[model samples]
Each structure stands twice: as structure tokens, then as C-alpha cells.
Target: MGKEFRCGYGKFEVKKMLKNYLLFGLVALFAGLSLRAYAADDKFYSAEQKIVELKEEFNLPSLSVAIGLNNRLAFARAVGYSDIEKDLEANTDTQYSVGSLSKPMTGLAVARLVATGKLDLRQPVSDYLERPQYTSKFSIAKLAAHTAGVPHDTPERDLAEFIDVKDHQRPMDAFYVFDKHPLLFEPGTGQHYSSNGYILLSAVIEEASSKGYVDYLSSEVWDRLGMKATELDTSFAGQESEATYYSSVNKEGLHVRSLDKRDRSFLFGGGGFISTPTDLVRMAQATYGVGYLSVEALQALSMPVKLRSGEINEEKYSLGWRVASVKLGKDDKSWLALHHGGVTDNAATAYLLVVPECKASIAFATNYVPGQFWRMRGRITSILKEYIDIQSCDRWSFAQSSVDA
Candidate 1:
């Protein structure tokens, strides 16, 4: 009556077809299991569970995480609150000031420019800055690696003065900090962690690309990687999502308050980026692409030098990354890791990037600082270790009494 619907096949034939379909699906399922047995390994999930408990104990308002294993991001999650006052939950979109984690991003830009034949690692910085009157002693490589022989700037108002002058119409206003100081060394002769040295490199990026540092990062690197939640701008100031940095009145004292957030113009290339933890994990993979630099110029980005000496100083500087060796297993050889941390009195930010033999990358970021660095380091180290091993155990202890509001 209904135009003989399904007249082409009898009921018996339809049942047989459906049975075959289910049989094929079951076969595919078993094949998938066998494939995973050889390729996939559970590495970081257990560690992540412990970390969640730790964050709750610490009373952290928010936390965002991204973990990579077996050459892919195995897990990512956002927990707690981004805005404690509003009871807003933290999510992968929550952006935190990445602080010194900005270094590797700058290095990537330099590498991309190099690939395009737009930058030369060995070229003297004077060539880009037109500071020929000064001796052409150091090269761009040293500057990127922090072995530029430059000492940290010495002035109480260095940051304050730079912040005050950044918004001016004149271009020279931002360079006032360097104009006030003298060279620390002849460049490439020694190594020291100098934020000022990095700020200078941003100037080089601008000169080479004819673009502002922020614009370059946004369009060239971050946007291209689809890192929508990450940004380098001054707009985050006084925003609800931004974490209030808390530092003790004195280094050892328990009293604390929010540190004043300065204009991004002051930090420039050295350390002025806001990102969620998920974006940062994406960044790590982009930097280490399938056993090769994504582009030819990026190859030079990994060129490292001894940045420090002695038993504790194991890291070498490679472009904008701090490269180190880590032990992951008993019979397994050590893996190369890039690490860095940022401190602005009130905020403590640390990043550990372990590129295992299997090409897995692991990264972590935390907002609160307990005022004791050694204790903080221990906790951070434990979290990383747990992720590497996939073990379940409480690594950080935040007080439940303090966490409940």
C-alpha cells in the first residue's frame, strides 16, 4: 500500500545484512585493540588525578593542564575556579600570564625568520639596532640563548621607568632602560640570565619582520598554530580572569598581597605572554615536530651552549629554551628536556618540557607560590615525575581548611 517500500529485499535478507554489519564491527574493534597494544601507552592520567587533589588542597582558584605522550596530547583539563569571587570554573580557555614561558615562543619566531632567510643567528645585534658606534662583539645567537655576556640591568626604577615611557609616541622611549646602562660583557664570552637581553632581541624581531613583537607572535606563530586563547597584549590588566599575584611582604614573611601588574611593553620579548595551559602544550609540539624542525630555519633554534657550570647548573641555552637531560627509566637512555621558570615576587610560574625518546612531550603550569622556593620546586618536580611515570600519589599538600570559602 505504501508504494511497496523495501520490496527489493525480503526480511530474511535484511537480517543477514545486519548480522554481517555487526560481525565486521566486532572484528574492527579487536583490530583496534591489537594496534593500541603496540603503539599506545598509558603514561600521565594517574598523575593528573593526583594533581587535581593537590590543587584543591592548595586552594588554587584555577588550574589548566595539558599532557602529551606517545607523540600526541593524551589528556587536557581545567579545574577549580578562574575567578574565585564569581565562582567561575577554570577551563582550557582560562588564560594565565605565561611569564618566562614566553622565551621559547620568541625563539620560534627567530627560527622561522631564519628559515625565510630574513635573520642570521651569527649577525651582530648592532647590525639590526644600528648601534654601530658600540663594538660589534656579540651575535644574535648569544642574545637568544642568554649567553650574550650581558648582565642583568641594575637600577631600582628600570621596570618603573620603562613602563612609564612605553606608551609614548616616540620610538626611543622604550629603549630608555638600555640607554641608562652600559654593556655587561663583550657578548658570547659568558652566560647569564638577563631579561634585558631578551627585550633587546624583540627589537631585532621588529626590525627584521617590520612588525610589532606582539603582532608577530599573534599572527605568525600563535594564530597559525590555532592557539586562540593565548595572546600577548596589555589588555588583560585588571581583568577578572587574570590571577592576582601574591607575594609575601618579605621573602620569608607569611604576609602577602597582589603584586602590581605592569604594562606588557616593559617585558616585551623577555616575558610578556598570557596563555592557557592547553595552548602551551600545543606550543611544545610545534617546537619539536616529528624529529625535525618544522622548517629549515627552526633547526638553528635548538643550537645550545653551556649557560652555566657545576653540578646544579645542568641546563644549556638553545635559542630561547633551557635544554637539559633527564632520566625516565632504568634501561632507557636519558631524554632531552627544556625547562624554565618565572617569578615576579607574587607569581611563580614554571614550565618543564620533556621530549621523550618516543616523542612524547609533558608540560605543567601552576599559579600559587607558597613563599618557599625549595618547597615549591619539590612539589613541582613531583608533579612532573608523576606525569612521566603515570603513578598515583599526592605530591602537593594545600590545606583544606584554607581552601574552603
Candidate 2:
């Protein structure tokens, strides 16, 4: 066996070859992996460290941030507990009520439908509804843009009624809550934020597609983008992995008992979806993507409503998105950014900011309002900038133009 195992070369030659092989192995190992290892070590680790510190600094029950860079999700993380009392830790998959972020998603859907000739932005609300509740003077575009005269919320519900919702009603049920009320302002004359306006938009979606609003949105938009985790927020009991929304201020954290399980289905078109940050990022990219939404669709959704004075709506509201001009560098020219923020009184704080110039989208949600939107925005923006340099970005607001900043 020893004789059979002997090499054809002498021991000296064998040793030399073995040494050469060892050197080559070492060279390949270092040369092939060193750059990648350094890049990850510098970028990914730095981002992780900052994100962790941000959670502790804010004392949030949970925080999830996802970023799409260069047209793909490059960074995503969830920090803290999704359920603080159950001690359930939040992961990237944790679902929080996305609140008004749902509006832009609806807007994106409307854009696609318009491009495909399935829907029309200029069509009146009467054109889509089985029984048009409002005057036909206003167009679907105005409704989607929140320039429609629709009231901002259900006038039928008292504070108690709003807080104690416990039904899994149809999308049309929302109309009964506000359709009886008069318009807040003359349609297309002004901008008034209205979840009810989007409810009308949802009715339009349902009527135009001959399918339920959620069904059409899920199949056509969310499911197509691989956003399986997003869905209309309902008051069903014990939804798996749902975060308990807290409004009380406590550094230690709010308990499960203090939260209410309200139904969000009433605003399904505007502020009623539970989603993960990753899914929001996906939705943002898809909204900006040409493959999914044609150029005509993009233009239809991108036009900010101009007031009777021929000025852009003071809120800069464009379709479902609130947009602004932003510049990443002092020397850089500004570009349009599409963004929206959502807050459900006791549910969560959510924001989606899409910057097409850099092909980057940032989506973040906190289970509770952290009470420091500007601080959070700056830090999150910095983190993304550090990881991937962005020359320009679109914008989002946390509140009305004055408060949202």
C-alpha cells in the first residue's frame, strides 16, 4: 500500500509542488474575497450598528426600515418587539398598520388601470359607482388627489364609534358613513386631506374591475410585486403577528391592555393596510418602475392637482403621494420625490419615500408614534446615504404641510 501510494515525482519535487499549491490557495482566498469582505464589513456593519442604536435612542416598541437601492431591496431590518407584552421580537416580516401609506398604493393601482384603459382619471365618481353618492362635477383624479370635496373621515361615527369598530364590512360600507355629508369644499378648488376620498377611489376600483377592492389590489398590484405580507387592515380577532398599537407615552413601553383592536377596513383605500417595511419598499419600486406602470400611468398619477388659482395644491399632493423637491448635496440640483406618511392613532407610524433619481426607496414603520419624526427622518436618510450615495430624492410628509414637515 505504501509503494502504491508513492508519487511519480521524488520527495523534493512533491514538496515543491505542494508548497506551490498552498501559495496559490492562499492567493485565491485573499484575492477573490477580500474586496467583498471589506465592503460588507464597512457598509453593512456600520448600518446595523446605527440602526440598533436608533431603536434604543427612540425607545420604540418596534421599528422596521427597508431600502431599495439601484432598483432592488439592498437593506432591510426590524428592531425591537412587535408585541411588547408577549415579548415577541420584531423581525423583517413583522406587520404594522401602514395607515395612510395605503393611499399611494391605491394611486399606483389607479395609474396602472388608467394606462391599461381599465379606468380613467378624468371620469367622474358617478361613472364607477352603482349609485354615485356625490356630484359628478369632480373627477376620479380629484378624489385620488384628495382635491375632491369628500370629507376627511366618517361624520357618522362619534369618537367612541370610531374607537370601537368591530366589523368586517364590505368596502362600500364606508360610503354610508360619509356619502350623506356635503362636500368639504368645491371639488378641484382646494386640497383637503380625506381618507373618505380614497374610500370613493376604492369603490371606483371595485366597480371598474368587477372585483372586490382588496381582491383586485392584492392580485393586480401587491401579489404581482411579491408583496405577500401586505393586506387590508381588518378587526378580525387574533390576526397572526399583528402589533398592538399604543398611543400612551411611556419610555418603558406600553402594555397590550392599553391598546384597542379597531377595524381599519373603513379606510381601506386610504389608511388601512398592515404591511412590513420590505413590502412597502417593493410597492415603492413597483410604483416607480416602468415595467409595471406605463409612462401614461406614471404621468396620470404624477400630476399634482392645481387649484383654481392655477397653483399646485398647497400641500403639493399629487394623486396619492405628497411630493417635494429634494437635493442630497449642496451642489446638486433638486428633483421630485414622492412620499407619504401614515399614522393610526393607536396603531403605527409609517412612511414611504421614493427617490427616482437615485433609484432608491425608503420605507419605515414604528409600531407606535415615536414623537420624533424629524429626528427619525434625518437619521434614516443619513443611514441610507452612507450605505449608498444618492444624488437626489423625492419626498414624503408625516402630517399636513405645516405639521408633517
Can you give the lDDT of residue 78 in candidate 2?
75
| lDDT (C-alpha) at residue 150 in model 2 | 79
Summarize candidate 2's per-residue lDDT along 174-250 as a digit string, tens digits. 66667778898888788888887787788788888888888889888898877878887776623886766667665
Q: Which portions of model 2 miss their true places by more than 4 Å?
A: 1-37, 130-133, 157-164, 250-257, 389-405
Clashing pairs in 2: 99-271, 337-394, 337-395, 399-404
TM-score per candidate? 0.73, 0.83
How far does residue 85 in candidate 2 sit from its true spot (Å)?
1.9
Error of 2 at 278 (Å): 0.3
Give Cα-based local distance difference scores for all models. 0.57, 0.71
Q: Pick the candidate with the highest lDDT.
A: 2
Give per-residue lDDT, candidate 2, residue 184. 84
